[model samples]
Each structure stands twice: as C-alpha cells, then as structure tokens.
Target: MGAFSLEGYKPFMAMVTMHSILAVMNLLAKAAFQQGFSSLVFVVYRQSIATLALLPALFFLRGRSGVAGMSVSLRGFCLIFLAALFGGTGNKILHFLGLNLGNASLVSALSNLVPSTTFVMAASVGLENVQLRSLITWAKISGTLVCVGGIMILTFYKGPRILNSSNPYLNLGTALDSVHYRWVLAVGCLLVSTSCWSLLLILQVPICKYVDPLPQALWLCLLSSLQTAPIVFFLEPNLSAWKINTVTELWACLFAGIFGSAVCFYLQSWCISVRGPVYCAMFMPLYTLITVVLAAITLHEELHIGSLIGAVAIIGGLYIVLWGKAEDSKRERNHIVDASEITISIDDKEDNITGQPLLVNSTR
Candidate 1:
C-alpha cells in the first residue's frame, strides 16, 4: 500500500522532473544564443539529435504496442504531425526567439500563462468536464488565478536583489535602454508560443490513449527534424552557424536533445495520459519558480524577495488545484459505489416479491 501510494505520485514527479530539465535547457540555450549560436540551426540540430537518441527505444517497444486503427491510420499520422508542428518545431523556435527578446527569467515567468490558457482551451471543448456552478471548477479557476498572480509579481516587481553576482548567462536578456518598444512584440511572441504548446498538451491526451507515448515522442522528434531541417538550411545566412564552436554550444545542443526533447516529450505524454491535460499542465507555473532558482544559482543573479513571494503563490495555487482534482475524483468513486448499492437493493426486492408470489400460489 505504501508503494502503491508512492506510485500514485509518479506523474507528479515526472512533471516536476520535466520542468527541471526544461529549466536547464533554457539556461544552456540562453548562454549559446548570447555567444552568437544560431537559434534556428540549434532547433534543427536539437530535433535531429533527439530523433537519433530515440531510435533505441524501438527495440523496447516491440510487441508491447496495441495501438488500434486510430493510432496506425493516416489520421494518427496527421495528429502526430500537428503535435510536432505545434510543440517540437514551432514551440522551440518561438521559445528561443522569445529568449532572445527578453531575459530567460522574464520569458519563463510569463509562461505561467500556459496552464491557465490550456485550462480554458480544455474546458471549452468539454475535455475538462467543467461546469460554471461547480465548486471543483471554481477551485481550478482560483488556483490558476493565484498562480498567474504570483508570476505577475515576479515579472513586474523586482524587489531588492539578494545574492547578487555575475555569471556567463548574465547578459543574455535584451536591455530595454533602447528597445522598450520591443516589449510588446516580445510578449506577443511568448504568448503565441505558449498557446501552441498548450494546444499540443490538450491534443496529446487523445493521441496518447491510442498510441504509445514513446513512439509518439519519437514521431514528434523525427517529424519535427524533417520539417525543420530544410527551412533552416535554406534560410540560414551563415554556413559557420552549423558547426559547434564552443563547449557551451556543444553541450547545450546535446543536453537539449537528450533530456529536453527526448525525456521531456516522453514524460509529458505519459503524464497527460494518466492525469489528464489540465492536471499535467497545472505543473507549468512551477517552471517559473524552478527557472528563477536555477538562474540564481548558475547566473549568480540576485534572488529578490518578490521572487520568493511568487514562488509561494505558485506552490499554493498548485496545491489548490490538486485538492480540487482529488475531491472530484473521490466524488466520482462515491457515486459509482452508491449506484452499485442501489442496483443490488433493487435486485433483492425483485427476488423477495417473486418468492412471495410462489408461496401464495402454493398455499392457495
């Protein structure tokens, strides 16, 4: 029972680990981009590396897959293709571009929007089983609002800097001294990028049910590589950008491929499969908190008091959401129990009535 209870948290742990890998990817990509590495080329290389890394998983998945027509048919291919476009290729491109425009901290903080946006999208389509009057629904809403609130505090209000220092990634963010107007476009890009990923999260629920998560991730990586390679080659103005010049660039690409793309993709699909998309996405706000901590440690940046407050809010909000989801699940189980008891009672009553009619006829 203890092990079983612990196993229940596997999805939670996977999501947390996924966000941690993402935080590292964000840091490495920023360092490379600041050193003049091509973000477009990085996307292509990242996807290619990820595809190659996933090849060995094919051996493990043999005979274990039971995908039906919805998974094997052309429609399944289309769904995976669209997922790759929205998440693998398109999401990475926009995310890196957003990093170029804003600091990683800021970009990551703003990305707390993903959970709320995904929630809305899922609810709109009845994927989340939302009702306006439901208390459980309100809990989800309140939690999202609080999480967004925390992220907003972190973004706009930079209180006094604590543990202030300098590091390799210190200068990665764009300075607003001459580029104030770019904020709008920067935010717009991040918003759209996040929306794309959010939609992909929702899409994966059905896709994962029909297809295995590992193969789905492999297809996402492979197709994304194919889709990205040609455009990058043609559009890239610098041939020199293709080669890895520094150790930073080399490790960044490798880690982003192996851990960021491969591991994260699999974990995400698995989490959504087990927990539902909104539950899976509710962990997104933690990305901002984890990124802040990582930035402080690696970049030697100051951890402001506001950041601590924001972190608290993010954690609190996630607790609320999980509580609501748990309550909802318990209620569902109780309803099933109640329904079965009612059925048994009706069966007993019918038996009693039939037995009485036989006794009366015999006595007569």
Candidate 2:
C-alpha cells in the first residue's frame, strides 16, 4: 500500500472501534433502563463513573509535568464544558430516555440522521463548501432526501401489509402505540440529543486544535460528571439502590464509562484528526447497523423491512456525501499544487531577469 493508503487505515480502524463501542454502549443503556433506572440517573452514573476512571489514567500518563504545562484559557474551558454538557449529559440523557420509551432498533435507525444533519450544518457554517453543479453533490442531497423519505414512510405510512404482518420480526405495534403525546415528548428529547451530538462533532474540531485529544476527553468527562452530580443528588439520591445493584448493572456502568466514554471519545478525536470530520461522520451509519444487530440479539427487538430500507438509505446518503467531500478535497489539492507551481515559475523568471543564481535551496 502507498503512504496515503496506510495513512487512511488508522482513522478507518479508529472508526470501526468507535462504532463497536457505541453499539455496546447502546446495549448497556438498554440494560440499565431495563433495570428501572431513569435517564437522568443513568447519565449521571455514566459520566461520574467514566470521569473517576479517566482521572487516574490522566494523572498516571501525564504526571506533574503534564499537569503543570497544560493550560486552557477561561473561554476555552467554558467551551469545553459546554460541549461536554450538550454532548455528554444532554445527549446521553435523551438517548437513554428514548431507549426506555421506544424500541431501540427504531431509535437507532432514526439516529442515523446525524450525518445528514452534520452535512447541512457544516455547509451552512461555511465549514463545508457545496458544489451544486457537481453530480456528486446532487447525489449526496438526493440520497439524504431519499433517506428522510424512508424515515417518513416508516413513521407515518402503516398500510395493510404493515398492519397485517404475522411474522414475529415485523411487530411494530408496541413501538407504534408508544407514539402518543408522551411519546412525542420522548421524540423531542431524542431530537435534542441528536442535535447536541452533531454540535459536539462541530465543536470538537476547534477544541482539538488547542488541546491533546486524550486530556481533552478526560477533562470533558470529569466536568460533565461534576455537572451531573448536583442533578443526580437532588433528583435521584438513591445511592443505596445503586450500591446494591446486580453485578451486570455495575459492569454495564463501568463499560459505558471506560470503553464508551473515555476510550471512544479519545478514539473519535484521533479519527477525526486523521480522517477529517466528514469521513468520520460518514461512518456513523455503521454504528447504527451495529446497534440494530445488537438490539436484535440482546433485546430481542424485531426487525422490519422498513428498518432495513432505512438503514440502506442512510448508508447510501453517507456514501454520497463522502464522495462529494472526496472530490472537493481532490480539487483543493490540485488548486494548491497549481498555486505552488505558479509561485515557483514566477521566482524562476525573476531570477532570469536579475542574471543571478536562482538560490532554489534544493536540498536533494
């Protein structure tokens, strides 16, 4: 493989790891909810446990020298805190709540919308430049629309075929019945969670610019855990119950904090740095697929044709967007090369006019 191919391998591997962690986290969240934990309580436990685990690791890795030299401006600290709040506390809370109230498979399918949201937001903020004339760009937009259409079909259109299904895997009655007013509230929470997650992806670029990925992740986990402490204390102060939970529940919380929060956060940052945010975001549907499979195995959740179609649409859209992005990157590289050649040519002409050595500083 070429250098570029090897360079690409790292982020792809990181993304694979990230998706597996997220899928496992979803399974654990489902298990926690099954144990009758509230979303607020679950998130608080996740953050606090992860924070405690990460602090020791951070200290061990950096020692005093690492702690002393590291500096974050007040504004930077605030930004990181806010990102943690929205991304960690807010996102996880809603996700847990949604899973408690809805089918995990359905929720995971809907969560596949993250890449489309990110693409739209990035384009709006001028972080991603869209070329409307390009077929690749159109493919991306069309694919996104198709994905959204599939979601709408699944959500709103229950025809005779859907209503009369006898297959155990086609059961949506419970999930559909849950869509009452209270369920709307759950959906709203899930929307907020999804939005916060997308925002975290955007904010992470700038944060990584200033701080090391691991420490930044550690601090975010710490601060989010601290932020949740008061809420968990006042709202669900039943520490005794948590203390006496089954070994499985304890393991779930530990895995969420360590593998899901600390390890995944660091890996995501590393992946984004290596692959750029677009590529990282594009692979999210892989996580969704993992979530579906795990939900089916662990939760015994039924799978429907709509779910399969929705997954395909989401993945297809992601590929289209990534194709456009790759084209944009290629164009950018070509533009840079052209500009460099122009500068060199102009310098050569000036040297010829001056009748002097070119002083090109050729190291070769």
Candidate 3:
C-alpha cells in the first residue's frame, strides 16, 4: 500500500497532470490560430481571463496565509515582472505565433528542449551544483547534446509518413514540406520560447519557496496582462481583430486562461518549490507525446517517421539526464553521511583527551 500510495508521489502526479493540461492548451491554441485569431489578442485575453479568475480567490484567502498583506520588495517585484515578461506573456506570444506558423505537434515535439535548457540554467544559477570531475557531469552534458540533436532531427527531417492522413481530403502533408521561410521563423520562435520558459522556471523557484505561490501567480498573470495589452493595442491598433467572434475562440480564451494560465502557474510554482526546475521539466516529453497523438486524431495532421525517431531520442536523452541526477544525488547523500560520521569520531577523540564533550556544528 505504501509503495502504491499517492502520498510520496504527489509531485510526480502533479507534473503529469500539469503537462496534460498544457497539452490540451496547445491544441486549443492551435485551433484558435487556424481560425484567423491573432496571437497577440489571444495572449491578451488569456492573461486577462487568468488575472480575473484569480481575483476572487485572492480576496477570500487574504489573511489566511498573510498572502494579501505581504509587501513585495523591489527585487521580488522585478522578479515577478521578468517572469511575466518571459514566461507569461512573451512565452505565450512566441509559442502561439510558432503554432500559427507550425502545428500543435511541432509545438510539443520541440518542447523537449525545456528540460535540457532548464538543467543547464539551474546549474548556472547555483540552484544545482555541477562537479566537473564527476562522471555524472559528462552524462548531463551528453544528454543535453543529445536532446538538442533530437530537436534538430524533429525540425529538419521528416523521413516518412507513419500515421496516414485520417481524412484524405485534408491536405496537410509532412508538416514541414511547404516550409521555405516559415520553417525558419517557426523553429526560431519555438526555440526562444523554450528558453524563456526555462528562465521562468528558474525564477519561480525562489519566489515559490519564500513567498506565497498563489499571489505570485496572480501578480505574474496580472503583470503579464498589463504588459501585453498595450503592445498588442499599439501594434494591431484595430479593435476588430481583438473580438472573439466564434464560440471556439471564446472557449479557447476561457480554457487557456482558467486552466492553462491560472491553474498551470499555481501548479508549476508548487512543483518548482518542491522539485526544482530540472525535475519539474523532466516531464516535458509527455506533453509532446500527448500533443502529437491528440493533434493527429483531431487535426488530421500526419504523423511522420521523423517525429517518432526524434521523440525517442528526446525521451531517451531526458531519462539519461535523470539517471545522472539520481547518481549524483546518491553520491552527495553518502558524502554527507560520511562527513557526519567523521565529525563524530573527531568529537569523541577530543572528549577523550580533554575529559569533556565537544560540540560540533554539522551545518553544511
């Protein structure tokens, strides 16, 4: 029962659920874009709805956790703004644009980059330690390299069609076939969006650990909405494009906001607090897999040989990275235990000589 319990695996379950939500969001976003919806407008509505959804709960839970009364320092506020800029608004903008240019499958297939990028970013920021001499270090580096290669394969190569076109009438073939300039644009946008997501994950670690996760999510969404509305207004200028004409468009907005933004941000913040960015990102391949299957079924998008091979490489490399982390962590725990034993031995020696016990601080 203990082995089968959810108690010890809550973080794992949370991440799986989080990515599943995101998978649905990608499909909705893709459908919305296909219907001539503007990416910027979609972002604005998504953020606005997310912010509004968080408002009532914010008031109700105000003093319970002292979250409402807590003051944000300049540094904390800056972090929130940066996170909004990159993770919330900008990430969505770029991703939606990429989705417009590409397909839902592309959006998820390339998502494997998040864990690789986050692992490196986390190590650089001192959240994760890197020991040069450790063999695990090489595994991390190699896995990162393999992950990048997998993404390259996904973007550049579509060897053969694996999943036949569900509808013979629909003519979306080898998703990347017609790409002349659009392919470059799509790949660039997707890669940059992945980087922004990685940075957002890193920034949230500290905020979620010290501050209230709920308010940070609120501020993040609110700031994102505030920041995006003006730019979208300036560039688009025409209010007509902002209109949600169809029911699908309206549904996309609500679903993306309530589930994708609000719930995802809260879940992501909690996951980051408990698991760190790399661990949180390790489930990204599942997102891609879900989107790939869903896209094929619903969108009638062709599933190709490249996607399968690339996905395998990406998932394999991800597990390699996880294995390296596990080994490194085991070594670290053993080292800590050995050091404590050594400290006790030295304390015993001093006590024998001085006839008095010596106090030792084992704080590392």
- Could you give candidate 2's per-residue lDDT for residues 1-364 as a string of tens digits? 6988978687888888888887888777767667765667767778877777777777788897556535787877878888888888778877777767665665676677777777777878988777888786786688678767756654543334322334333232224553443444555667677788888877776787667877788778888888877866787777764552666677778888888898888888777776677777777777877887787677766655655665576667667767777887898999989888843334566547787765766895
TM-score of each: 0.80, 0.82, 0.86
Tens-place lDDT per residue, model 3, 1-364, is 8876867698898899899998988888878888888888999999999999887777786755545444687788888889899998778889988887777777887788787788899899887778888789889889989988888777677677778654322222234344535755777898999999889878876666446777888899999999999988997899889999888899999999998999888888778777656577678888988888888788877777776787788888887888788787788889989888843334456547786547666784
Name model 3 segments beyond 4 Å from true.
1-4, 62-70, 125-127, 166-177, 342-364
Q: lDDT of candidate 2?
A: 0.72
Error of 1 at 287 (Å): 3.5
| Candidate 2 wrongly placed segments (more than 4 Å) | 1-8, 131-137, 157-186, 233-244, 342-364
Task: Kindly list the per-residue Cα lDDT of model 1 for residues 1-364, writing each as its tens digit.
Answer: 9999999989989999999898889889878888899888999989999988877665555543422222456777888889888887788888877776655666676666676667678788887767779999999899888977875665445455566653323422223345544544565677788888888877776676557778788889999999988888887967897989999999999999999998888898788777766577567667877887787777665556665676567667766776776787788889989888843334667667775666456555
Worst 10 residues of 3 by lDDT: 167-176
Which candidate should be chosen as best, given lDDT against the real structure?
Answer: 3
Ranking by TM-score: 3, 2, 1
lDDT of each: 0.75, 0.72, 0.80
- C-alpha positional error of residue 127 in candidate 3 after TM-score superposition, expressed in Å: 4.2
TM-score-best of 1 and 3: 3
Give the local distance difference test score of model 1.
Answer: 0.75
Clashes of each: 0, 0, 0
Model 2: what TM-score? 0.82
